[model samples]
Target chain A: MRNLPSSEAGAGPETVDATRRTLLQTGLFGSLLLGAAGATATLSGCTGRTEATAAGYKFLRDADLPFLRALLPGVLGSLLPAAGMERDRLLDDLLHRIDLSGYRLGLPSQKALAQLFDLLNMRLTRRLMAGIGPWEESTPAQVQAFLERWRGSSFAVLNTGYRALIKLVAGSFYGTPAGWAAANYPGPPPGPYQVFNS
Target chain B: MAIDDIYTKGIADGWKVVDASTLKQDQTYEADVAIIGSGAGGGTAAEILSAAGLKVLILEEGPLQTAANFKDMNDARAYGELYQEGAGRATSDGAVAILQGRSVGGTTTVNWTSSFRTPPQTLQYWADTFALKGGGEADMAPWFAQMEERLGISPWAVPPNANNDALKRGADKLGWAAHVIPRNVRGCWNLGYCGLGCPTNAKQSMLVTTIPSALKNGAQLVHHVSVRKLQFSGGKVSGLSAEALGPDGVKRSGVNITVKARHYVLAGGAINNPALLLRSNAPDPHQRIGKRTCIHPVNLSLAMMPEKVEGYYGAPQSVYSDEYQWKHGATGPAGYKIEVAPMQPLLGSVIFGRYGEELKTGMAQLPNMQSMLALLRDGFDEQSPGGSVEIDDSGAPVLHYDFSDYMWDGFRRAYLSMAELQFAAGAKQVMPLHLDSRPYESWEQTRTAIGGLQYRKQRVPVFTAHLMGGCAMGEDEKLTVVDSDARFRHADNLSIIDGSIFPTSIGANPQLSIYGFACKNATKLAGVLKA
Candidate 1:
């Protein structure tokens, strides 16, 4: 339901400042590496993106920043227990995933991407943590057991999460510069199908 | 392939099937009798009347959903398909009680598939108390027989599935009598998805049986058209004005249509029918249009067993205990039939969510538990709060309900009975569906556990899918919405032949009774049309 302004508005200093502020507050810089590792674990659980068309693949490039921005806070909250070590590792890995300098120039293009990552992170945490007993009592071996049980199964923990993420990205892209032209979604609405040839 | 296959293929080839909400008002027409609903009563009436050569039109407010469309019959689609917002609404106080069904076939689409004729004693009670002439068991026997045959109602020939077995085991352990309740399903696969809309078309919902037959017999059904008011002239119904919901999900101009009919049948179920009458402002000196709403409110008890029961893999509801139904010296209220109900993981999560963090932990043990519902046949009392269904400025029916203390006490008793049964059945933990109370670990703890509970004060949520009585049928106009013959007291051609015409709530699933009454009423309507 959230409609973002077009890519042309990405140059606004207000938007840049806000994004930077959110990143700093949430310590996204530190959590980036861990988030990537979590995302990898999540992606492993997913069956490959069957719904995404070849053209749809391009939307993924512009989707990273917003996806990460939204995802970092939740990831940090989940990884808080080991934030000091996990934060440094996560940030390093995220930087490796994309060129931070290029993203800084085209932050709006990366907004959807950020949102998708964030969604992935949230979903991973939900599946991994849900119904598992209190974290305090969960030993390292138990956590490993939980990961093995959920992470590699064909009934991947991340399928629903990825579906939701794709839907969000689709919504955002249609509302932004990538708009209808990027996805080749029809416009002005086609007429109803005629039952008869006439 | 098969005859039904050819028939379905032919129908699918010919008709213009539109989702009710997508229906436009540009296509308006007239009919001999306009039946406003497509559930048990309305569907049967449409079939009979249409076959009898009367032009019948069925108006349903909900979309026409089929078995193939029910793959995702979870909470989201439930809101769209079922009524009372998926489960019946409780009083604002959240005492657990609910109304049922809103889709094409009404509650029949989401019902438990159990079928029972109105017991002979119940008919006698109606005759003795209300003076409802010509409605004795004998008068209704033929109709009931026909309906039963059409629905293929019969007791389960196969062994009760694992869930039912668990319930039977629990009942036997407690020395309670149990039986396989008859269901109207043919070729049931024990696919534990009845409440979510049966996928196989095995469950004989009106959508599959009566509505399809009615349509085949030339009964025109207009879905998503909500009848706002009964058009009246000279103290009789002339037609009705209905506003169709626009594609944008709001009422729009050019979407309102008026249809003229010589006869009108209000089968909008118990709740909406009365609200429609009230909104129409049709003469009702009786002031009894929306009075005497009776919901057979059910209570749920979760029995934590030692084995991984996998409760959601079988029929949604099958086993029952009618032993306590008419208990000895039962002066206050009739007892209930304890039936095992299938609750899938998602739904189980919602029910478990009510138990708070304890249930969160219990979810880890989900595969180990079995659950069942206690369905009570409650008596109608003047003290029970009556709800009025009136139209808002936008012409949508708005419902107002207040749960009575008397019903709450019965609910409490039902819950206790279930918990005791579960304990006797050797459950390690027994959880009452009471939101305000903690789950009891033992039967000894039940009294203390439930005693301090304030269902009304805390507003615990109760859901009922079986809502009956709004436009009740009786002998006199001052006492009911329609006369014994299902004719509206004031309107010449308008009648009611659904659950809305039940003078009082029957203690069982009302599908068979509704069908029987509709068939009988359709015969009467046919007699009038023939004349």
Candidate 2:
């Protein structure tokens, strides 16, 4: 929350780049594996290769990595073209895009990573909104409107980034212990409150 | 007489009460005590002093609004009825924000009715910090008890309204502590329109309570009379000069009224009190009259649920958490009170906004979604006492406030906490109330995403309904406009008994505390007059 106060100052370009790299290296591969595992498991109701990979990553020593791994694949797969690149090829591509060298920088890494994930979620959500249907079926007018809304000054882009991040965090943390602990969440488990449950 | 008798007896007392809009100030008037502004502080003081057989005259700038005339929570009508400028005006920047009341009853007519006595610890701090005397909690206990009884303060025992129930559900789910908020109301129908002048007259605003009592005790009130300046003679307030504005918003010719009084009380609230002093040039070289304005900045966080919440159909706010109120080493401003406030569809639509087909899907599920707000009370900082309310060359009240860095910091923290809480409490998605901002899915993402929020040089939203501490009280004339007794240091015959005299922001709804302090000051002033 201390960083939350001064968060108004625009992050330096170097900091943003470093933060991005750290998120890719630490968070990207695990999140992808988890997403693929959750998707394929929900698809066939069977523990497939994706699920085995996800389970292996989930047992990792670092807390955030497994959660992110489980979260990313589900979120990204939900955003992916249903019948396109092979799951392994997509995961590999995402890993290649990851930049992890910035993790060594002594800045508040957790907060910076949280911010990076939020920005990524915002970008992805905008894509999701714009691509309500398959890209081929989407109208030029709809695409233009989405781009117009998202494009502009750095602040406007950052705002979209933040919203996406919050959505991703909420989605990943939905039923998980880590997410619940982070939120200090107190609500009916997966349902609306019953006034007189007794 | 019973409380209800005062209104009936006021009409019989020959006080010549008239609708504020219909009132045209006479060229002249004379009274023993001329009070400006007729809200909680002024109205209470007028009642106490008049009951003691003092001839009292009360002048209020805004038109009186009765229950019959109050709009039923319609933002537009209510804005015209109670707001200073129809609610679209901005601070120094073009950021749209909310200010206090402008009608005869002042801000009380639009308050949430949350009532609390001044905390004893805060009083002790005030006494020690400002060298104020007789302000300890023990000295103020009787006043608090009296005011609470008069206002009918009670913990809401009625089943939590739907909105409040939602908050409770969320809190229960999160294992956080929450409780029913005590308010100053009797037989409230839970119509959820307190912010727009409750049409049922159930809320204990001064319009229904103090004004009638003061009138019954021989106090005369003239509304729509805009006081321009205080006439000072040898450092004592001799009279006040004012003009009556026509319906066209222009000054009516020859309707100028000069009121002569042995004593004067300035109760024009935080913003206008300092403005009036600056306009009158009442001999202050301290430059501290309008310098330390505090508005507990608040923001809303809306959550999308799977069932119908119909948030606007119940109470405006019902429950809150005090767990974070004194957190963080007890130095920084405490965390926010997560409050349940239902809003009308128009406002809700704006809040939910365009969020892809998911938002459209959410809108279709509107009945299931509920919203709660977080009001953060930031610490007092003297960045800009807010530009003093000054008459432009054309003589209309112009108010300008600069956003301080500390206040902005508080707002950021509040927004982050609210989003995190909503997501935790089973919200499918959390949307910020910012005009162009998108919804967040996770708390971690929200923190990072919000860190990128830049202070727009052009347009941004800064909202505030809590305005306090403009004409602060202190022992030194150089630091504040009023002394410990609420007496103006420069003018022996003048005093300020309102939120304007708050030494610092009290970090809560101020109505009850304002009334308590007003009663305390009035009691002291009564003794001084008799002596």
Candidate 2 achieves a global lDDT of 0.59
Writing each residue's lDDT as its tens digit, candidate 1 over B425-456 gives: 77888877654455578898975676666655
Q: Which ranges in model 2 have alpha carbons more than 4 Å from their true place? A: A1-198, B1-15, B19-25, B71-73, B248-254, B346-369, B381-391, B394-400, B455-460
What DockQ values do the models have?
0.02, 0.01
Residue range B178-275, candidate 2, lDDT tens digits = 88877888888676667777666688888888887788787888876778789878989878887765542222433667889889999888777876
Which prediction has the highest DockQ against the true structure? 1
Task: Predict model 1's lDDT versus the native.
Answer: 0.59
* Per-candidate local distance difference test: 0.59, 0.59
| Model 1: lDDT of residue B52 | 88
